[model samples]
Target: MSGGVVTRGRERRDQQNGQNSKTIEQKRDEEQVQHAEANSLALTMRSGLEAISKEIRDLKTEMKKDLTTLKEQVTEDVKSEINDLKREMYQQLSANTKTLQAQGSRIAEAEGRIAETETWNMEVKDALCKSLKQQQMLQDKLTDIEGRSRRNNIRIFGIPEDKEGDSAPKYLHQLLTTELSLPPNVNLQIQRAHRALAQKPNINSPPRSMIVHFLEFTVKEMVLKKAWQKKIVVEGRPLIFDHDYATEVVQKRKAYNGIKKLLKEKGIRFQTPLTKMRIPGTTDRSSTDPHKKQHAMPWQRVGERREGTARSAKEKLQEFERITQDSE
Candidate 1:
């Protein structure tokens, strides 16, 4: 029995040992499978990471290209806008300059016209002044001629007009001898005698004046003086004698109307010495004979009362100087 029991024990021990060794061998096999699976997983992970990095690099390259394109387009648009603005400004400046030039030309033209008008006005003024001076000179000459024509003639007013027919001259000669108290022995030469040329008036109207021409100038003045001294009367009317004067000279002598009226009111005897009328108290004629035309107006002597009325030379100079000032 002991031997049998020992043999079983030995068998059992051997069986145990065999079982443990098989278990260890199986574990080793499992470890080897796990290691192989881990290696395969690590390789797959590495391949995925590489794929992701390549995708990121491709995205970065695409973004850079888009940005560069956008930048270039923006620069081109800005350059185009600047060129359009520059062209518009240039056109506006050119238009303004043209307008200013036109205005300047118009102003210059207006100024030239104004200057020409002023010059023309001055010329017209000078021409008018010259014409006025010529007219004055012509009037003076005409006055002188008219006065000369009447130098040897006398006008007799208050002479009746009658139908003496062809004997008008003879009738006047006989009347001068009788009415004027002329010496019958003295041959008073008469050139011609005639009534004024006019239509016959009513019977009650004043008689026409008679024009008497004398052969000599001295005789004409002598007759006028005698007629004035004698105060001849005809048909109950007093005859008046006067020197034949031009109408202009008579009008000029009318300046003494106030003086004549004053003298008449004062009962002072006044006479017209020549073309100029005078008041006797102020000045006297230098002629010995008051009726002599030769000694007329040439010399005038102011009386003692008028000596103080004479103006000084300095006063005359002052007046001359003031003439231009006053005219201005």
Candidate 2:
């Protein structure tokens, strides 16, 4: 029984040792499993961090590229706008300069025209003065010729019209002798006799005036002086004699009506036949003849100057050429 008891206790002791060894082995296997799980978790965390970091880097790169592209585009647009503005300014300045040049040229042309007009006016004035002086000289010559032509003519007025049976000169001589009651032997030489070259209505009408031409101017003066002294009447008609004058001389004589009236009122005897006022007895006479009513006679000078006639187109061109040569 003792041997068996000892052996049973030994067997119990061996079984306890085996069970402890199995438990130890199982604990060791559990520890190894936990360690493997921890290692796997750490590997997973590291891989996730790496993936996040790569994503961040990719985003930063994309943003940088986008910013660079934007900057380039903006710079190009600004450059284009600046170039356009510069070109527009240059074109506007050029146009303004051209316009100013055109206006300046027009102003210069107008000034030249004004200067030419003033010069032309002065030249025209000078030409007119020369023409007037030449005309005055011509008029003086005509007046001198007129005075010499009327030196010998005599006019007989209020003579009876006659259809003469004989020569007109002989009949007039006989009439003058008979009317003057001259001596029967008086020899009255007559040159020519005729009525005025005017129309006569009838033979019985108041007779037309007669004009007689004497052989000598002295004889005519003698006859005129005799007629002035004697009141010669034929029947109931009275005859008169005067100096034969031209129509212009007669008109000039009409202007002396005031002087004649004054002379008559003062009982002064004056001769009308002479061109100058001639007093038979007195020598003092005025040179300012009443018959001369013109402001500027042929003998008188014009005191005031007048603007001359405008030059003809041809003359103006010639003058312009002369002025241009002088200036050059």
Candidate 3:
């Protein structure tokens, strides 16, 4: 009994030991498979990391190259634009300089022309002054000649129109002899007689004046003195007799009308000879006297000045001729 029990116990213990060994071997096999899977996954992750790093490096290199090319292009474009602007500025400056030079030349030319014109204008002014002086001298001479021609003539106013017959000289002689109460034998030698040159007047209008030329100045003076001494009446009308002065002398004498009227009102005795007034006791004298200092009338001074200007003009002309000869 004890030996059989020992044999069963030993068999039971050997069976339990064999089962535990198989279980351990199976666990070892599972651990080896897990280790292999872990190694594969680690390898796959490392490869992916390497690929990403390589791509990033390549992209960086490309970007650097593109930035360098863009910088060079921009620099070239800027340099070209600056060169264009500089060339344009130089062209404009050259054009402006040429325009200024042209204007300067024009201004210089205009100045020269103006100088010449001024010289010409001065010469023309001198010539005009000389011509005017000569014309005035000629006018004075003509006036003097005209006055002398009219010295023996008389003008009669308040005479009826056509009173003088066909022979005017004969009629005027008779009329003057009767009206003036002259001696029958005193022959008033009238050279010619005529009405003033004008249209015939109406019956109501005043008659035209009559002009009579006397043969001698002494006879004319005598008649004028007689007429002034006493009033003369013919038919029914009073008549006036006056010396027939030249037109210029008459105009000059008209300027003295106001002074003459004043003198008459004051009962002062004054005589007008040509343009000069002579008061009997005054220092007034003819302008012809060079030695005496005369109280000259305004008209007389003007006449004397005109005569002096004429003489001065002649002297100036002579002086100009002398200067021209000397220069030549």
Candidate 4:
């Protein structure tokens, strides 16, 4: 019985031991599952860290590139400012130099003008002194000439009669005393004759075909010469010169022509004649008889007996023939 009991205990002990072994194996499998879970969590955390590190490196690279670009921009801006400052400085310096140079030139010119003015004043003073002495001599010479000859009117020519502007009036008067107070046989007109010839409406003047006019004082040739030398008009058109007789003839001719033109315009009946005439009060030809009141001079040879005494056309022809025969 004791042996059987002992064997049963041994069996029970073995069975318990096998059950503990199975529990041990189950605990090991639980530990393995836990370890695998821990490993999976570590791998996931490592992958996240790697991704964050790459992002940080990329951000750092972009920041470095932007910083370099910003540095380059700042450098260019500073260089441009420096260049602008240099240009402004140079411009100011050049302007200052030019201003100084202009001031120097003005100063030099002012000094030169002052010197020239002083010289001119001295020359004017010398001329005035010399002119005063000459006036005394001229007075004496003039008195001697007056004593030698009787007071006579000398016909002078070649002086300006009409002009808008010529020599100063005072200067021209001075010329009359100095150049034209002449002796006999010497016409001061010779001095001005050449200029008149140059401007002779026949040919022309040189350098330019400027019509020059010489003043002709009525009768004093010496005074006229002085005036011509002192005063002359230079222009492109010709100057019209008229003598005393010529001007009178021209005035009469113009008056006659004007009367004729007025008569023609008013439609007056008048015979044309060699000399211009007027129509009675208007522009009539002059034909009148002194003996009769209502009578007019015979214009044509109307009566045969009247032809001998009266100034008819046939009588005028006979008179002209008699004069011609006498001349021959």
Candidate 5:
């Protein structure tokens, strides 16, 4: 019996060992299947990472292109601005140059005109001087001819400088003494040089113009006629003398007014001033003296005063007042 029991225990132990071996084999097979699935998932993750890297590279390239385009556009804009500024500078410089040139031209023209005007003024002065010199010579000849021919000669020469054109007559007087020395029989005397009636400026007193007076007479009839032969010059102008000049001019003046009348009528009216008196006049010819006798004015005879009273205006007033008071 003991033997049999020991055999059964041994059989039981062998069965338990076999079952444990089967269980271990099954567990190993399950582990191998799990590892294969895990490997497949890792492979999928690697592929997704590669796709993301490619997308990032494309984005970086697009950004670079945009930046290059923007830089080029900015450069073009700057170049345009510089060109505009250069154009404006050129225009301004050109305009300024034109303005300066115009101003220079005007200044040159003004200087030229001033030079011309000065030359013209010099010419005018020379012409006027020449004319005056010729006139002076003619006046001298006229004066010399009159002085040389006459011993007791009555002459009229040279209007006053302030009046017409006669100043000192220095040139004429010198010519007479040097160019045409007077004969021993002839006497040259300026009777009086006085102011004329057409008044002008004076140095010493009130303003007065001038008139020429002279003493002249012919030694013989031939000499007298020759002196006044034809040429009478006044103020550098020629004149003709007539015996009836005074009478004819007076009649013409009564008819009309002219420069001739002004020359003849504007001076002292008499050789000697007459006193304010009503006196009788008589001629030297005894036969004709009867008709030449003059009478006192009727108004002067009527208004003549007797031997005057001694009373003055004041005394007369007092006498008049006394008389009035007595009557009252």
Candidate 6:
């Protein structure tokens, strides 16, 4: 019995051992399967990592190439734009230089024209002066000639209008002979007698003066002297006689009216020869004569008594032109 029991026990122990060993084997198998799966997963993960790294490297290479090409293109475009700008600036500078040169040339031409105009103006001024001098000389000679023509004429004032009738010379001769109390046999020799060339005056106005031409200058002088010596009356009016001087001479003589009145007040005797005022018994040199001492009395030209020297016709003309311009 003990042996059988021991044998069963050994068998049992063997079975337990076998079952344990089978279990251990199963566990080992399971471990081996898990290790194999783990190995496979690890291998797959390594392969995927390697693929992702390769793709990243390839992408980096392509990006570098693209960046290089873009850099080159941008550099080329910048250089081309700079070249275009330089060319445009050069064109603008050239145009400005040409414009300045043209302006300079025009300025030079204008200066030359102005200089020529100035020279022409000077010549014109000189010519005008010469012409004025010649005109003044001719005018003086004409005045002298006009004065000589009236040397044998007398102007009578305070005469009634149309009193001389149709035959003026015949009527004036008889009137002067009776009024002046001249010799009946003596011929007054009145060549022509007429009223002044003016419109007839009204009755209230003074009558126009009568101009009488005598055959001889001496006869005219005699009539003037007698008329000045005594007052002559015809009918109801007093008459006056004077020399028929030229208009210019009369204007010049009128300028001496103030001086003549002053001289008369001072009881100074003076003679007027043409336009000169000569004080009797006074032998004084003219004011224009620098070598002699200037005196207040003697001979003084009318309109020049208070002036230094006579103005040239050119100067007078210039003054007249200035006055006319101012008036305008």
Per-residue alpha-carbon lDDT of candidate 6 for residues 50-154, written as tens digits (9 for 90 to 100): 999999999999999999999999999999999999999989989988988998999999999999766545444454544555797787789889989999999
lDDT by residue (20-98, candidate 3, tens digit) is 7878887887787777778887887778877888888888888888888988999999989999988898898899889
Query: Model 5, range 140-161, lDDT digits (tens) per residue?
Result: 5664454443333223333324
Q: State which candidate has the highest TM-score.
A: 3
The C-alpha lDDT values of all candidates are 0.74, 0.72, 0.80, 0.52, 0.49, 0.81
Q: How does candidate 5 score on lDDT?
A: 0.49
Against the true structure, candidate 1 reaches a TM-score of 0.51
Off by over 4 Å in 3: 1-96, 201-205, 235-237, 279-328
Off by over 4 Å in 2: 1-150, 163-166, 181-189, 201-207, 278-328
- For model 2, how does the per-residue alpha-carbon lDDT over 1-328 read when each residue is reduced to its tens digit? 9999999999999999999999899999988888888888888888888888888888888888988998998999999989898899889989988998998898899889889776665555555545666666665556556644544556777666664335777877787677666678865556667777889758667777776777777767777777778887765778887877666566777877889999999999887654557778786554445564556544433565434433553388688799999999
Clashes of 4: 16
Clashing pairs in 2: none
**Alpha-carbon deviation at 23 in model 3, angstroms:** 25
> Residue-pair clashes per candidate, as listed?
0, 0, 0, 16, 6, 0
In model 5, the runs with Cα more than 4 Å from the true position are: 1-67, 125-328
Q: Which ten residues in a row have the lowest lDDT in candidate 2?
A: 305-314
Which whole-number lDDT from 0 to 100 does residue 142 have in model 5?
62
Judge candidate 3 against the unseen true structure and give its global Cα lDDT, from 0 to 1: 0.80
Return the TM-score for candidate 5, rounded to 2 decimals: 0.26
Residue 155 of model 4, lDDT score: 21
What TM-score does candidate 3 get on C-alpha atoms?
A: 0.60
Cα RMSD (angstroms) for every candidate in the order listed: 17.9, 15.2, 10.3, 31.1, 29.5, 11.6
Model 2 has an lDDT value of 0.72
Could you give me the TM-score of model 2 versus the true structure?
0.45
Give candidate 4's error at residue 56 in angstroms: 1.5
Clashing pairs for model 5 are 152-216, 152-217, 153-216, 153-217, 161-166, 196-210
> lDDT at 181 for candidate 6?
91
